[model samples]
Target: MNITSHHGDDQVRIALTGELDMATTEQLRAHLDHTLISRPRLVLVDLDGVTFCDSTGISALVAARTAAAAAGSHLQVVNAHGITAKTMQITGVLEFLTTPPGH
Candidate 1:
């Protein structure tokens, strides 16, 4: 996957492209870890460019949300489409992952 990020005063927007699977999940985790260190109030993950997502990818996203919660931050997953969105919905994580920042 290709990940790019933009930092703001209280938020970090991460845009991801390509497949989100086992091979690329570690990369995403690393990015999240690095970003969360500063305790940004919001971490927005944009998955518009992610055409495919496996179970491992969904796990990664859920883990991200959990990690953010543990850090007293918010992680919002957005812009999911096609199979990626379907997977999230079918797996019962669509709403959990897509909750708006700040509740």
Candidate 2:
């Protein structure tokens, strides 16, 4: 997976591409671990380019959100569709991570 992040308005927007599986989950985990240290107000994970997602990937998202909340930051997943969205839905992760900002 290719993970890139941008910082703006006291938030970090992380963009992800490629497959999100066990092979690439560590990279995301490490990236998120590093980002959470700064305690940004918002941490957005954009899965616009992600072509696939597995259980491990879903777990990482949950863990990241948990860590972010513990760090006093808000974490949300956005732009997830296609197979990735289907996988998240199948695993019941869509409800956990895909909530919009206000609701």
State TM-scores per candidate: 0.97, 0.95
The numbered model that scores best in lDDT is 1
User: What total of clashing residue pairs does each candidate reach?
Assistant: 0, 0
- Please, what are the lDDT tens digits per residue for candidate 1 over residues 48-84? 9998999999999999999999999999998998999
Assess the local accuracy of residue 71 in candidate 1 as a C-alpha lDDT between 0 and 100.
100
Candidate models: Cα lDDT each:
0.96, 0.93
Question: What lDDT tens digits, residue by residue, belong to model 2 across residues 1-103?
Answer: 8999999988999999999999999999999999999999999999999999999999999999999989999899999999899889988889789885567
Q: lDDT (0-100) at residue 102 of candidate 2? A: 64
In model 1, which runs have C-alpha deviations exceeding 4 angstroms?
Answer: none
Model 2 collision count: 0
Q: Output the TM-score of candidate 2.
A: 0.95
Clashing pairs in 2: none
